[model samples]
Target chain A: MVNTILIMAGVLMALGILLALFRFILGPDVTDRAIAFDVMTVSSISVIALIAYFAGRVIYLDVALVYGLLSFLSVVVIGRYIERGL
Target chain B: MEIRETVGAAVTLLGSVFIFLGGLGIVRMPDLFNRIQAGTKASTLGTILSLLGLAIMNEAWIWKLLVIIFFVLITNPISSNVISRAAHFRGTRMTNKTVADLLSDKNKKISEE
Candidate 1:
């Protein structure tokens, strides 16, 4: 049962990533792309956590933590650049 | 097979669905700010839900999971707020259906003075 649920989750998350990528590719402005990137990274964090549960590894949680931190920083930097050409 | 695993799987599944909806909103929203609102709100909840589910499944790792949740709860809103403010200040146009824009109006008034 757990395996089946995990498979379903993987499929859903993949579809989510695909949709976010579509937005990223077709986004008219840089801000649009930045938000798209933000959505994608957040979803990926969930996917990674699910994968860690599936594989029975504790280390991957740490990876997810670092990924969240960097993604947040990237979004902030992009916002600053958009605001004032930084 | 245990009760905990079943509950955890259910929660994770719910979270993934939310994540999918966030992506859909990003694609379908009319403008940048709308997209940002949708994407940020939904994905933040989704991430929290999934992480909570994972923590439940592995009781020993609850502390680390809570830390991740705390970081997400703090950073997601701050980053989105920053981006939206930047977008507004940079003069990103709103949709036609937008009812009011006090900030832009105030900016215009100040410039007029």
Candidate 2:
């Protein structure tokens, strides 16, 4: 039953990611593109966590965590650049 | 066979759904500010929830996941705020909305006075 639920969640996440791709192409500004990039980061993190669950490996969880933090930092840095009249 | 496990599973699943919706919002929204609003607040929280679900599944990795969540909570809003302010400062006007031009008009009035 838990596996069934995990699969369900994964499917939903997949659909969401596809929609985000749409925004990436359709967005009218640089900031919009950046937002789409951030969304993709979040989506990939979700996929990583689900993969960890299916694999039942402790290593993958930690990897996903690290990746999430790194992506968050990158977003911050990029945002800062934009804020500084870029 | 266990209720706790079921709860964990449910939380994780729900988190996944929310994260997905956040991504959808990113793609579907028309403007930069909208995407930033949707992506940062919604997706970050949703991702953290998903992390928590995984943490609950196992005991040894819970602490590490908490650290990641902490970082995400701190960074997401700050970054989005910075970007939105940049967008505004750079004069990326909303394409299809009517807003009273108070700032410019006030500047002009002050200049005249």
Candidate 3:
């Protein structure tokens, strides 16, 4: 049952990624792409957590945390650059 | 133990569904602010729930998961605010249906004095 649920969750997240990717590709603007990227990163973090669960390793949670921090930094930098001349 | 796994799986599934809805909003919303509002709220909740679910399933890793959750709770809104402000300053136009812009109005009021 746990395995089935995880598989279903993966499929749903995959569909989410596909929609976000569509927006990224069809971008009428750069901000749209940035938003899409943000969504993708968040979803990928969840995926990484799932991977950790599957592998029975506690280490990948650290990977997920780092990934989240880096993505947050990148998004903030992008927003700052877009807001001003940086 | 069995009950714990079942409950955790249900929560995780719900979180995944929310994340998917957030993606749909990001793609479907007509304006930048609208997209930001929709995507940020849903995704933030989705991420928190996902991590919480994971932590529930794996009791030993709860602290690390909580840290990740706390970080996400702090950063998601800040990033979204920055993005929306960038869009505003860059003169990203709203859809025709937008009735008012309080930020611009406040700025105008301050500049007048």
Itemize residue pairs with steric clashes in candidate 2: A23-B27
DockQ of 2: 0.67
Ranking by DockQ: 1, 3, 2
For all candidates, state DockQ relative to the true structure.
Answer: 0.85, 0.67, 0.84
Q: Per-residue CA lDDT of candidate 1, range A14-58, in tens?
A: 888899999999998888898899999989988888878878888
Best by the DockQ measure: 1
Question: Which tens-of-lDDT digit does each residue in B1-113 have in candidate 2?
Answer: 36666777788888877877787677656566666776667778777887788677665778877887787777677767777776776777664654565665776798999
The model with the greater TM-score, 1 or 2, is 1
lDDT per model, in order?
Answer: 0.88, 0.74, 0.87
Clash-forming residue pairs, model 1? none
Error of 2 at B7 (Å): 1.0
For model 2, what share of native contacts is present?
A: 0.77
Better of 1 and 2 by DockQ: 1
Q: Which docking category, incorrect, acceptable, medium or high, applies to candidate 1? A: high
User: Is model 3 an incorrect, acceptable, medium or high docking prediction?
Assistant: high
Query: Which candidate number maximizes lDDT?
Result: 1
